[model samples]
Target: MLYVKIHQLSERKFKITQIAKELKISRPTVYKYLGMTYEEVKQLLEDPHRKARKLDPYRDWIIAWLEEYPHLSAAQIRDWLLERYPDMEVGESTVRSYVRELREIYQIEKKNIVRQYEAVPEQPMGKQLQVDWGETKQKTINKKEVKLYFIAFVLAHSRLKYMEWQNRPFTTRDAIRCHENAFQYYGGRTEEIVYDQDHLITVSENAGQLLLTTEFQSYVNERKFKIHLCRKADPESKGMIENVVKYIKGNFADSRVFSNIDDWNKRALQWLERTGNYHVHQTTKKRPAEVFLVEKQHLKPVSSLLSFESNHEQSITRNVGKDNTVRFKSNRYSVPLGTYNSATDNQVYIKIKTGKRQTLEIRKQLEGEIIAEHLISLEKGKLIQNRNHTRDRSKGIEEYKEHLISRFKDQEQGRTYLNEICLKYARYRRDQLAIIHRVIQEDPGWIDEALTKCLKEKLYSANDFRDMVQYFKNLKVAPVRNKMNDSKGPKHAKGMIVTTRSLDAYTSILGGAAQ
Candidate 1:
């Protein structure tokens, strides 16, 4: 009790002299107890004559939890104790000390997940660079949480790193810009670059044949750098940049409050200079900044920046859907009808223009002809279609109308009805004639009755004629179901069954409940 009290008092900002005076002990005794580790104090308490500790009853359960989980903290065990035994009284400090003693005595060391890696031979200076991406959740000035993303680049030989931050996820164009920025920062480019199979750079890796995104491919061709794309799920291929990503997240961005992306990046550059590059690397034992001085001489000279105006738009390949549409940013834009021919390849290229009001130009991948264009939609899941791309309705409408009129019993009356439809619904003549043709296909006899009813009732539209034919057809089928339910009570309807209860039965049930 005195030991715990001394420690507790010390924790409350009590000085050694104040602790000794309050505990009625000498300063030397306080110093000796404070110096003793939790294990040592536990040994003292383990003497045969020592009084039992408050947590002695729950010792076995704590051991079991620690052994099973191996990662349970002292505070978590205390929380579990309070949850299970609400009547129990124990301080957090006392539980912490007890948990520590139990762990040491049982040889139950907490373990961390460690990745297996083989030593990779270092590449020659200016030979290669590794790339990776990371994201972190940070707090804004209002204390609201916001997610920030960043791309990291590291020179393979010197381990010199550069990173750029964005408030939004990066596109292929943004990645190209970041690549240029990294080259400018390093004063040149390496002969080859290593990267994970990121979608911004690569579209697919079919049987090891890498298909690069159009924008990234163009950028690579312009810079003339070789690419080494890492296989899927293989972090060992680019572990150096992976380690840099972790180091930046843990050492720099973990506790930093984000104001904006630009400020975050500016501060990140300062961090790289003072600590990241200045610190001796664990493997090489040489500062990256110092090693980079020699590597910079070996790097290829950087060319002038490419004109953004010429390559301002990014082209992405998309498979045209059966509806002759391509999906971009959650919305589908129409191409010309028949663009989706399943017999041939249905691929098209979409060139996205990035500006105040963005637009997209779609072209046939093989022919490179401009097949369609539309202003990009801000709304999600929308189908933006151009009316001109729809099949022309005026091509064979007059002949098709005559064919539908030929199916009617009286061609003269059919002509009168069809002409009236054309006169009334000039815009929807094709649709009305199509519906009438469909009705003739469904039941030839019913169309005669429907036509007679329409001419008598002045129902000129095809929809009314279709509905009247459907009513006559349902009348023809009603007797069959009526015969099936003939033995049932009168309460049963044509399409539904209803059970009718008498009022006397309900009154009897209520009377029994009252009793």
Candidate 2:
């Protein structure tokens, strides 16, 4: 508690003596904790310099040299100590033991300490936040027994919590995205954040030194926030966030039925406001939202960092295809007409940030103008197009009708038939015009008197019109005479007229002579 107050006072640029006087502590104690980060103070408290050793007098000096040159061998460290303390009475055995201890303790700047957590004192508002992820099997609308993952970031001071869910195991980029949202939800970020040595962040330890993954390291450098890594297999270190995760599962998600992921998230956000933040916290005896207003004062302003997410740099470029869309990964997203086509002869390159459940923004490469935006789909070969992109309806039937009229103006009957079909199937002008073209090409008079007769029945499909034309063609009239010079045949004289089968009145002879 004194350490935190001293550190806080130092952050406000208080002098060491002033902080000591204000907090009623000695000047030396204030100086000790003043410049140290939260992680460093946590490490110091976990493993203090309380052990008495035979080479205790030289421990500080030896550890300092070892920390400075971690590459130095034990023999080299011993020699350096001897040169500094020529009159010292420490033997080689005592020196070796002390050097080994120093390497184990002080060689690494930060060590992951493993121990059971004691009952922690309440932290001042906006001092720290604990972060962790929880997983559970949930059934969604289309998916059954899905592995649902949620990240919980709980403020140690106000007992305020923020939760975000994902359908998959979180990557380093996803975790950073979660942090960005959590900070935004809190309206500001805490001075320090605690984690459980997440594999996405921590790669591996090298000689007891906790090494952050390259991607996470870059993120940390950009964000510039303090990180406190908990000991392995130790949930008690970040007990608050762990409890919040459990509470979310039991109270919020246990009996809730999910219609879809989007609705579920919307309800979850509402639940956080209503039940999670509005209720009085058992520990703080105040509503988290109310306490958060006070915590907001002490918090580092969110404006100090970037307003948007930090891990959105991984982008792939793609050219716009002939369909006025750019294929990113496997799916295609629509852009404007002038953006890409043969007329311009210039390519529109779009940058794609790929992910599941991703909102893709299509920006112009040169101007950085957003041409289009769409929700990214996981399914391949999908063209995610917006109807507003190509909204010109007159470009189709109005323009094409003139061309058709000009092509067959000489055929007066065909032109009249085209006009009739267009007016009759006005709602389906495109389809009816296309069918008129096919009929004109195949058989000019196929839609002659029969079309006029069929218009009374009001048939509208292109296929039905085609089938009617074929039925008209099949109804060939029988010639009265099959003679060589039979120009005046019965069907030729009167011209053929088709008739439907009158089933009930048709006279049929049983053996050709019984009629």
Which candidate gets the maximum lDDT versus the true structure? Answer: 1
Which prediction has the highest TM-score against the true structure? 1
Q: Which regions in candidate 2 have their CA more than 4 angstroms from the true location?
A: 1-118, 141-143, 206-208, 304-312, 315-515
The digit string of per-residue lDDT tens for model 2 on 1-515 reads 65666667878999878876676555665666666777887886567575667677776776676566454445445444544565555555777666654553342422233444456778888789998888877666665567778888889988888888877678766787778888788888888889886666775554557677555676777777888888877777788887788778756675344566677777678778766676578767899888888888888766545533333454433556766688776888888543542322223434455676668877654335677888878799998988766634566776766655564424464456556667877886765566555554565455554454455456544445555666777785222322457578534323455576654445443333323
Off by over 4 Å in 1: 1-31, 34-113, 307-309, 313-360, 364-367, 375-383, 386-515
TM-score of each: 0.50, 0.38
* TM-score: model 2 vs. ground truth: 0.38
For candidate 1, lDDT tens digit of each residue in 231-308? Answer: 888888899999999878766675457898888999788778866786679888899999999999999988766854
lDDT of each: 0.79, 0.66
Worst 10 residues of 2 by lDDT: 340-349
